[model samples]
Target: MVINENLKNEIEERERLERLYQNLVEKMPAVSYVMNLEKEFSFTFVSPQIQVLTGWDPKDWIDIEDFRLKCIHPEDVHEFVEALKRSIKNHEPFHHEYRLIHRNGDVVWVEDFASPLLNGNNMVESYQGVILDITNRKKAEAELIYNAYHDVLTGLVNRAYLVERLNQILSRRHPFSEQPLFSLLFMDLDRFKIINDSLGHRIGDQLLIEAAHRLQNNLFPTSTLARFGGDEFVILVEGEDPRRDAVQLADQILLDFQSPFLLDGKTLFTTISLGLVIDNGEYTEPDEVLRDADIAMYRAKARGRACYEVFSKPLLDQVINRHQIEALLRDALKRNEFNLYYQPIVALKDGRVVGFEALIRWITPQHGLIQPSEFISLAEETGLIHQIDRWVMHEACRQVQQWYQYGLSSFPFTVSVNLSGSLLHQGNVVQMISEILAETGISPQSLKIELTESVFLETSPSVNQQIQNIRDLGIQLQIDDFGTGYSSLSYLQRFPITAIKIDRSFISRIDAQYSGTEIVQAIITLAKELGLEIIAEGIETVSQLHWLKEAGCDYGQGYLLYRPMDAESTEKLLRNIGKGDEVM
Candidate 1:
């Protein structure tokens, strides 16, 4: 056959194009290479950038495929080979980042992206790939991931990462094969807040770090310990019966804290409450398990701290009930499940209405007439108290405004609402109250705010700011159940409070014992000295009432005066009292 001019010209152009492509590959930033599938150490093409990235010349890689494999970090080589095998078998693209050993004896991160090149017959002919140096990006990513998953104070895995790891291990591909028995051990350091109070959080943090190191040393090598925020930790144990191993682990952990932690030359001691639960084998998801474990941990704390409890069905039931209540509360405002009942706060001397305390009642559709004591703390713990508090303020204010409009304007009755610690912590309590008062056209002076001593103790400076804001709005603040708390005179001055109510416990026993009488008198005298108004609670008997009146108590609230009643009954009772039909 004679050679055609057109065929010869086409060959020359193809050769030129091949040379241009090779030049472009050589100029690329990333190293480019091709290796034959049949050869163990064969490189058909190697880019010149290999010298710049790996300190290996292109001549050193060509025809030596094993050289690249030898340069792969030893720990990552097996996974890399397996990935390649998988890509080839599936005829798919592969991408992975791994450490590489450079010729300068330094480790560099590289991301390999390759695809199985197939022949026309649909067979994997070889792998065509690019290698990119992603060391700087990987370093940044690793730092971010570390910060995200670790607690800055103790250098322990945080709650988010703990949950992530738990989810990963509890998946269907769980590492444990012996029936996949695993345990989640939740630990909480006892009296941790006391440490922070006494020594400050700076020392508290050092103590936590020391405690973490001690606990970490005590855990089994396979066990994973995570700091689940604050002084809490969650340990995940695989391939062991939780009842046996968890108890032993808990015992060992308890021993770890036996030695005192010396921080700032001060010997500090802390104990832990542990709650462990075995995998129920019912395939209950990870979140539920963690929640139950946490509930059980709280139960352990309630059962006189520093003890371990194995989670039981009862704990699960309690958690489920709490969860139901939380869900109900989330929708309670929209469903109008809350109503306020006003209990009369009367002047003991005149036996006349002076103010009213607004108490919240939950009128749930499924569970009717839920008591405030039962769900009030639940609201605080679940972060629903802020909403509940706002609702009570608005509703109570609205009621007071309605009563004024209904021609009961001369009652001289102030509506006092209770403030929970959660609400105080919101930092917007004052703003919320101002908004409610503005919306309801109720005078801030008529909206008295009452808080328990525990609320004051737990309230931060932000909460103090909120209280100040409320006070600036002309609202009065009263510390309820005052004598029941360990409050100092100095701390009392820190708050701009208008009143303090002697706890019912002190007054209930005023008739029962001399100590109670003396304590009640001391509380009244103390309140008067502080220039604070006094309210005596639980005045049931005439003798008790007379004693409180003599003690200079300004107000009284109890079943003796009148039990809490519905709005209609309260109005009827007030009318009857005005007509001298009832003694109250």
Candidate 2:
């Protein structure tokens, strides 16, 4: 009777433990299952959560033949089957993430984990596994990856992706005798900044989107297009004749841009400048190819927009030379290699010196006596012009102040300094000028500021106010190379300009044979009507001088009147003038 009671207690304990195990399986978030290895990995048992997780009854999992394999996404089925077979054959645990097709035809991502079930003899019997739905996590990961490689505004590949693809192509070795495997085109919209500044960024962004669509639609299906940031784009082209294909595409793009872009109810016109570089066995890195393509693109811009240029050895050499020059220019200012040369402005009526224009000259230790034409534009491009301009202003003012103290001239002669458009656009330009005058103790009236007509093309309210402020400081303002740029007559009346210097191209053709005489005469008449002083530049001949005097031009300056001279020579000339000697 005691043994019978003990057996009854053991049966009760086993039933209680079975009930507890069933409750835990029902409550777990994952679907737990057991597969029979002897029966082609068929399910032997499945938790109740299987129905809630996959919208299928738990009994169907055990009754169906190869239902699990059939439910896996077609793209992931092979990988899933191979992983499962490896795990079963090796008697090891299985861990894999794959997509499954739900009953409703939706893709459900799952993470599957399984371990080999062992029998009493420690031999593998069946596989015990759990499936956890991870669809949201996989979607989040996919979105993150997409955002990393795409441009937010244009919805195109970004620079990172472009470089990555380029690296991949460059890694493959190709024969030197055959044509390149691909071509790279680096292009940018010409005058995009004008549109952005005038119409605002909203319009600019819309235009970029439209441009991206047009470029994509025009290309072959195999081509890859990417937005390289801020109105710049890159394209990778592959074909039997990539060079020819690239050129045709570039031409088509240029032709397409001739059609106006209608953005925000405004019709705008723009052009593209493109650079083409074909793959050669010479380049082993992506940057080298990109650098060459960029160099070619700038060359197209230099040739005027709406064009394309191909990369060549000569172009690469030019770029290298420019880089070397830029490097030298960075140290030129610190080494005191810059000097100012003064060219005298003569009174057309009396042939007497009235003022001098201070011009910058770079005297390098390696290349002696470099002209402004050789380095001024480079300086402006590299933003070193501001430093050079400031130095010239202070040095010229200080020298003129010393000349006054020495009584080198009997009359009040002005010194004019050429200011770049970049300097004129500075917010602190007025304050900088005021400080220079105060430090040098030079009279503001005797220091004239000369600006090119290009500075007036994009003038804003703040820029106008800055000009007025500079004028209020008692400094005179003159427009240099007046007729060479896109300045209108209204600019003269609107700005605080006191004088206009007719461009040299007009003065050089002022002889009786050319129609340039009429242009110069018209300029002089217009200046007189506006009550502005007119100075004729590049008056190299006697006939040009005679014509200027006849036309009532106020001042003239060129090689004929005086060449640019060093400070010591200028001082001697000033002394000679103070003594009433004929120096001109």
Candidate 3:
């Protein structure tokens, strides 16, 4: 009776232990399985969680031959099987992360951990493993990688990815030839800043997105387009004829931009300038290629918007020269290398000097007497024009004040200083001018501000307000080089413009043909109708002067009237004028 009771108690203990093991396996988060090594790794036992993990019944998992192998993702099946075989043969632990196909045909990412189960003879009997679903983690990783390489605004590949791919292509030798044939096209949207400033950043961003779409649609499948930065994009092209393909692509992109972009019910138009560089096996770094392409792009812009230019040695040299000049310009102001030259604006009736236009000249030690045409645009681009403009204004005002101190106040002459559009657009421009006038102690009427017609291209209420404020200070504003810009006639009536100086181009062509004469007559007539002062620029010949006088032009200035002179010469000229001498 004692032996029977002990035997029943042992049987109950064993049954309880078996129940606990089964409960733990079923309750675990992972899918647990035991497979037979001898039967090609077929499952001998699988926990009930197999159905929750892979949508496969535990019974089917155990009954089917090689069911797990068949369910493995085709891409990873061979490696998975080989790893399992190695682990079983070597009696080692198996650990791998791979994809698995669920019964419903969805791909599931899993991290599998298994150990080879050995019998008493030290031979592998079966394998036990657990698969933990890591699908969410894998997706998160993929999303991070994608975001790192793409631009957030345009959803195009960013600069990092482009450089990496370029490096890869450049490092590898071509299969057929020693060097790879490819091209890099750098693009910039023309006058994009005007649009951005006028319409706002939100509209600017939408335009960029639309531009990316248009560019992608026009490109070939083999091309890679990247948003290099604001209003700029770069494309990498590879094919048999990269030059021809790139040119064709550039032409197509320019043509594509001919259509207007519709953003928030507003119709907008923009053009792109392209610089193309065909690989010549000379560039070892991506930056070198990008630099060349950028240089070429600026050349296209110089030629005019909506065009493309190819990289060449001359272009590179010009870029180098420009960079050197730019470096010199930064120090030019501090070194007192800049001087003002005054050209007299004469009255058409008496040929008496009524005003003088202050023009800046850079007298560098290395390259003496640099013209404004060469460095003015560069200064504006580098944001140095603000300083240059202020210097010119103050110096011109002080010089006029000196003239008055020299007893030339009876001359009734005004000094005009040219202002860049960028300088005029500054928020504090009016305040800056106010301070300059106060500090110099020059009469406001003795100073005039000359602006190009381009300044009114995108005028706003604030700009008009600034102009009004300047005019309220008793200073006159004149449009310099008029009739050459895109300003409408309404601008004359809208802004507080005191005068219009016809562009030199029109003046130079005045004696050439009847059409030129007609254009000049029309301008003078328009000025007369509006009661605005008219000044003819670049009057070089006697006939031109005669025509201007006959046409009722109020003022004129050019080589025919007076050449630009240094301060000493100008003061002497003013002194002679004050004494009623025939200086003109």
Candidate 4:
């Protein structure tokens, strides 16, 4: 009887331990499961978490006619079953992620892992594993991928994705008539900087978002638009005839900009320039393709903004030449390879030499006597103009001081230096000029700063104040190329301008049959009325000079009077003038 009681206690203890194991399985986060592999994955045991995963009770899952069919997503069921069969047959472990349909029709993502169970003889008996809800992790992964490929500001595909897609299209194209064609439209918004600076970055950001959305709606079905950052965008298109398609698409984008962008209760008008390149399917280089489009876009900007240009070899050559010249110019500045040629300005009445305009010359070792037209604009664009302008100012002032040593320091017998718009806006520009003049010991009255009408475009307080600061230094301020741009009367009334140079265009038209005579005469009359001096530029013929003289112009400078010469020749000419000898 004692042995029988001891046996009963042992059986009770064993049952208690089994219940403890079952309790732990039911409370676990993941579903602990066991399947009878003999009956085609028939479930012999399941944790309570299975109900949380599939919305089915464990007992109900056991009675279900087809539990796999009910819980597994239909599309993934076949693959899951095949992999399960292989694992069970080979006694291998398997891991997979797939959708599970809940009783409430919600699709849940799960990480399902299963391993074949073995008996004492090392033969497969059943399968057991767990299902983890990786739905949150999957969503996080998907979102990560989306963010990686898209731009943060514009929501367009970023440059990386665009390049990837471009290379793919390039690699897949056929070699002949059966091959497809693709084009890249590289473009940027013109005058965006003006708006961005005048307003704020907030307004600029809104404008970009709106513009991107508008451009997106106008793209071809097989095209991708990408934001290349900060006013620049690129489009990739595929078609039977990509060149023609590119034109149409670019036109549509340009047309979209015609309608003003309404941003934060402000209507802003802007235009874009486009560069197009058609792929012949012979290359798969992304950089080359992008570079070609960029080159074309710049050409469009050069020809004038608000237009598009197709890629050509000449454009590429021009870009390459420009880059090489830019590098050379930087070197030229450092090597002191630049020289100044003086062009004499003469009084119209007495044929007396008044002053000389300083002209820059780049005597490049590779290319002799590089003219300003070839590299001045490039310098301005490259932010190297400020340094070049400063050097020119210093040289001109020093030359005038040297002229003083020769007793040539009078009112109009000074040196005139051209000022770039960028230089004028540079910080403490007036201070810099004052320091240069103080250092060179050139009389402020003997140095005149010549500016174009672009200086008068904005009467902003800063611009006006800067102009006033320079004027306060007792240096002469004159407007250069007056008639070619906005000849605003406000310029005389607003700034400290003392003279106006009639543009070479208007001076070239000065004749007995001059069509622009009224314009020039009116400008002269306006200058005289404002108590400002007038100078006529580019007087090539005797008739043009005679007309300018007869028109009561104060001064004239051109080939008719005296061509630009070297400093030594200018000194000789000045000596003759001091001797009262006729220069004309």
List clash counts for every candidate, in order.
Answer: 1, 0, 0, 0
Clashing pairs in 3: none
The alpha-carbon lDDT assigned to residue 309 of candidate 1 equals 86
Candidate 2: tens digits of C-alpha lDDT, residues 229-314: 99999998986888788988999999999899998789888889999998877877889988999999998987867999999999
Question: Per-residue lDDT for 568 in model 2?
Answer: 95
Q: Name the 10 consecutive residues with the lowest summed lDDT in model 3.
A: 172-181
Q: Against the hidden reference, what TM-scores do the models get?
A: 0.63, 0.89, 0.94, 0.89
Give Cα-based local distance difference scores for all models: 0.80, 0.88, 0.89, 0.85
lDDT of 2: 0.88
The numbered model that scores best in lDDT is 3
The order by descending lDDT is 3, 2, 4, 1
Compose the digit string of candidate 3's lDDT tens values, residues 19-44.
99889998999988888877676788
Give each prediction's root-mean-square deviation over alpha carbons. 8.1, 3.2, 2.2, 3.2
Poorest lDDT segment (10 consecutive residues) of candidate 4? 454-463
Q: Give the residue spans of candidate 2 off by over 4 A.
A: 1-4, 37-42, 118-125, 188-217, 254-272, 301-307, 488-490, 509-512, 516-529, 546-553, 579-584
State how far residue 105 of model 1 sits from its true place (Å). Answer: 9.1
Give the Å shift of residue 541 in candidate 1: 5.4
Residue 292 of model 3 has an lDDT of 94
- Give the clashing residue pairs of candidate 2, or none: none
Error of 4 at 287 (Å): 0.5
Candidate 1: stretches off by over 4 Å: 1-154, 158-183, 187-223, 228-232, 237-275, 278-285, 297-310, 381-384, 401-411, 424-428, 438-441, 460-462, 483-486, 505-522, 539-552, 580-584
Across residues 1-584, which tens digit of lDDT does each residue of candidate 4 receive? 99999999999999999999888888878988888766566588888898988888998767665675568899999988887777867888978889999889988999988887799989888878888998899999988988899989998999889989977877776667545468899989987866786677999999899989988898888788999999999999886777778889998888888889988899888889999998766556889999999999988887768899998888889888999899999989889999888998999997888799999999988877778988998998899988999999999889878887877433348889998877655657898898999899987888899998867763346667888888899998999999776456776777789999989988777666755688899999999999999999898988888888888999989997899988898888777767767556
TM-score of 1: 0.63
Query: Which 10 consecutive residues of model 2 have the lowest summed lDDT?
Result: 170-179
